[model samples]
Target: MKKKRKSLFWKFLDGVEKVGNRMPHPVTIFAILCVIVAVVSHITALTGTTVTYQGVDPKTFKAGEVTVKAVSLLNPEGIRYIFTSAVTNFTSFAPLGTVLVAMLGVGVAEETGLISTSLRKLVLSTPKTLITIVVVFAGVMSNIASDAGYVVLVPLGAIIFASVGRHPIAGLAAAFAGVSGGFSANLMIGTIDPLLAGISTEAAHLFRSDVSVTATSNLYFMIVSTFVITALGAFVTEKIVEPRLGEYKGSHTEIVEDITSDEKRGLKYALIAMILFIIGMVLLTAPANAILRDPKTGDILGHSPFMNSIVLIIALFFLVPGVAYGIGAETIKSDKDIVNGMSKAMSTMGSYLVLAFVASQFVAYFSYTKLGTIIAVKGADALEAAGLKGITLILMFVLLTAFINLFMGSASAKWAIMAPIFVPMFMQAGFAPEFTQVAYRIGDSTTNIISPLMNYFAVIVAFASKYDEDSGIGTLISTMVPYSIIFLIGWSILLIIWYFAGWPIGPGAQIFL
Candidate 1:
């Protein structure tokens, strides 16, 4: 018998894989993009390409119209910038400090095994009837531990499903969906909150010098999205993916063992530490005269000490509980263990550090050349001319980001490139940078499970292959596609409702300017 021809969708996925394989590393892409921007600056400056636009500054409300002319970065002054500003740009890149600092705390937690044990406990204790939902939700929560969900919950999901007489691959898909597909959604802030918020802040500087995107900017939206993705993942798994997967005849069954007594005591101690921390924060922020609240306005969320020290607060939140867990579990016999955890986390960021170096230079050049501003104004003008506004505009942007996500898998790297352009563009169209960031996140996250270029895709495929010897990229992506589609549609609808109803995306963040 002749082999059946591949479907167009499968062929397209294969083509995407080939193209992604041909693409260079993110660092090289950024470096080349930096060069291209410099050359473009030369060409535009020499050609007298200028854009005249004006708007009220979102922060100061100062309305001004000024002509912006592209500066040639290929000149002597530009070449000096290329060399002299390297360190400054690298150090000043907003996401660098935030991610690094936050990781110290997260590292300690992961190193002490707080995060991984918590995830396993949550998953293993879940009722079998609710296993799919719990597995997916646990995966979403595992974002705090970085890639631990991919390694722990996913395989464990297979084991849990197989033990419960369900299709293991389907279980794997549910977990993968919640981890990667729901990446940007969490009940509380994670490392991504600071990373993406910092990038958004940097981009907002072009339009409003004082407009800062905080880690909590998208908190409320993501809190709701946590449930949204949980339900969506569970639904897709039970209804679509599981049925498609049929019976698990592969005979590889494994039991998911419970967390150890030491781990349970660790969780209890961690919970106690977390409660104490919350109380302390409340004492500091709940009272009108509290230290963390605004002295003048008594605002805790806006332009307050609490808001300013958010990154530190986040780090402390993790550090305290992590140490508590470590002590209870005997994972930390000394300060050295804590230091080791932080070191491990930082070590993993080596690639990120390299990417940031090149990205910072690109951002610096783009800013110096005034290219980002020109592009934003021009793009905004074109958007206005085309009559795209509000939800329509946001949906189009979401689609654009989702498409770009297919090729550029690194969230921060992609945002570092897209933020300067889209954030300012959307700001001109009467949206907040936080709003733009959330929309970008929706697009970024919803397509992650289906993207061949996503950093963890290969690992997920490998996880799938263990259950079914024949499972490959196609098997995994196809399983995940349902989650991607539903999440993209569901999340976008939520955003649309938020837009029309004048809802707050977070404590001090709004959907519109």
Candidate 2:
């Protein structure tokens, strides 16, 4: 009877998965949600109803009158507002701007064949016992180049596993787990560091009139988290995901190729260039009187040129090394070739641009209607009303954020809508913004692999299709669901443990009141 019940449950889940697979892309779904929100907001305005909800302020709640004006979707005024807001929001859209700019240099790396060669060398040299660790580490480190992991490492993982006579899907799963699932944890800081820090700073200001969280506030913790996640990922891949995959008998066989002389030379040049770049950066920031150091405090991270100009610094880090590799490898013969590479990279961003535009507009409309604030305020009020305190409250917030993440994938956008209410509300309840932000990160990241609303979910499905022509959204989601569940449970447990241990979330940032 129990076995029968389990079978029935799986059948029901399969049905739900099929239906979800047929749904629209996350961006389109969110766009539709935006229209619904707009229409409802308009009706609320017409009714002259008072909308009240909990906000960042636990004591005082967000209260507003719904007011909407009928404006033609095609009219100049309406179009102007939409377009203007969309552009403004897009400019501030954390991932888009950071990824695009970062790619300028990363394109050079890939165009020069540095990244490809490096990946090949790593895979070829690593032993079978350490393959999972290598794959996970590569995935974690790939964030340095933004989308490079999804575009390069994920496919490479499959190829590597196939070469080793392991299941390619298992390799893909392991790599994907690291790249997307463990995105928030990395040894080195990436463009997201500053983006999230800026948002946290803005939210923190609600409580403290003149407070700011530096981009590297969480740097030390994240560096430690990288190894922890990599180890955990390796364990999961070997013990669970790989075992579930069973064996590799795919129609498309793996091809094992020797590393070419040109590739080796290119990698050598890239390494040299990277070393030089690192040395230069260290010199610029190391000394007490170094230019990159903070002028007043002489701190490297708090208020330094290195952190302030990190975007440009990252751009140069990749560009200089990549250009050197290209020159040495003779892949880039002219400026035109370099330009073409960057152009190619930009071409891939077309879908993201569309998604960003729609997402931005929706977010703007939601904010305009004052609905997000109201929802956040009301939610916070209920939690406060329940008298939940301490670690329990943090865990509750983590679960709440995770649930919300299922429907809303964009971290910054969700935080934009959530932080104003949760941050201040939690602060009033004796919790800090840093703690709330940390909890949100844990929730946001663990579900990214399974969230259909995630922009890259389609891309992942497409990747899966390369192996199994019959693969669809259902296949991809089912394959990844286990990872999502494991990550959520494991990550939440870690957060709870950290909270109880009273660990600092960041530099001068506390996990407690």
Provide the overall lDDT of each model, using Cα atoms, as 2-decimal numbers. Answer: 0.78, 0.69
Candidate 1's displacement at residue 82, Å, is 1.7
- How high is each candidate's TM-score? 0.63, 0.70
Clashing residue pairs for model 1: none
Give lDDT tens digits, candidate 2, residues 1-513.
335325654455456557756777646666887778767766655565453422232223222222223333333554566666776876775555655776687677877777666656766788779998988888888876555577557866876777677887778878888898888788776756665667666666766657566666666557766787788788878875666546766775655566788767877787898999999989998988998888988876633677667666776777888888888788989998888878887776676667666666665666666554444444555665777877788788877777667656667666665676577677877777777777777787777888755655545655566666555656667667766777778777777777678788677877655
Backbone clashes under 3 angstroms, per model: 0, 8
TM-score result, candidate 1: 0.63
Question: Which regions of candidate 2 are displaced past 4 Å?
Answer: 1-17, 25-31, 43-80, 83-93, 137-176, 183-228, 235-254, 287-315, 347-368, 406-440, 450-480, 495-513
Residues 138-165, model 1: lDDT tens digits? 8899887565566556766776677677
RMSD of each: 8.2, 6.1
**Best TM-score goes to which candidate?**
2
